[model samples]
Target: MQRNFEHRKVALGTCGRAYNTPCIHEHSCLRCSLLRPDPQQRGRLTEVRDHLLARIDEAHREGWLGEVDGLRISLAGAEHKLAQLGELTTRTATVHLGLPHFSHLVGRTVR
Candidate 1:
């Protein structure tokens, strides 16, 4: 898992829930709802999203309607994952709470 996390960020996002089974999504990790995306993988995820956008555009230009639909689904999933990563950064902003003084609580009694 550690090696996968370090090296295969583009192809696989960590799934803490899955055990001893091949991915039912056939390694389409971005489109799989079970995927747990790592914020550290944001660069790779953005690349994937950009590529998907180019493919969708190409599919439209080539009149590949079925291909376009499938690409759009994957695109939506990729975008959702990107949004999750965005939220993670903002949500993890730390607010420091300094250590409490025991003296302050020493004489305090709970009612």
Candidate 2:
């Protein structure tokens, strides 16, 4: 049983859901059975977090505690995924873009 997986910005747990289950794909990455959360999808995840935050705020204003709670949990999970993805790639601290040091060229004459 080798399984092939594709890159997805938001993976819906379709495998676990038995036909017509209302699985909110974007908000369910953390609990997804087949979530391929890659570092390349960081930007999309960040945007999702932002959108969830706005929804959470709106829910709070509307006194919808249930909605706020659910949104908050999803928000936390997305944040955790972001942290994991963030650790995947590292930035080079010292990049040698300039020319190499040429101490031997000091004694060389122009041809």
Candidate 3:
């Protein structure tokens, strides 16, 4: 006599829900899994950029071209540095979050 058994596969991180193809973890639920900076950091950067622009505009309106030009250069440099930092943070977050999966794969391959 032969017996057949059927195995049901449960989605890995969704507690038995149907698997979502795009996200293997199934936790994103329609959201892109991109890392975003903390709200405070985002708000602070916006505030600083707005304040610098306002100051530059005020200096220009008062006929202070030298100050306005200096502020413009400074703001541009600061914005560039902020963008670089944001990129670094995002890369770091991606690597950090992926470490567990990477380790699992490594373990399986080594074994």
Best by lDDT: 1
TM, every model:
0.69, 0.56, 0.42
- lDDT string for model 3 (1-111, tens) is 122122222221112332333445344211222223243355555666688899998998999999987778657744754564567566744334443445545645532
After superposing all C-alphas onto the true structure, candidate 1 shows an RMSD in angstroms of 5.4
lDDT of candidates 1 onward, in order: 0.80, 0.69, 0.51
Model 2 lDDT per residue over 18-101, tens place: 344466664456655455466667888889899999999899899999999889888887887777666656655577798888
The reply for model 3, stretches above 4 Å from the true place, is: 1-40, 92-111
Better of 1 and 2 by lDDT: 1
Choose 2 or 3, whichever is better by lDDT: 2
Q: Which of candidates 1 and 3 reaches a greater lDDT? A: 1
**lDDT per residue as tens, model 1, 1-111:** 566544433344666443556767777888887777987788998999999999999999999999999999999999999988878778857878999778867877889
Top-down TM-score ranking: 1, 2, 3
Note each model's CA RMSD in angstroms: 5.4, 12.0, 18.5
Cα displacement (Å) at residue 93, model 1: 7.3
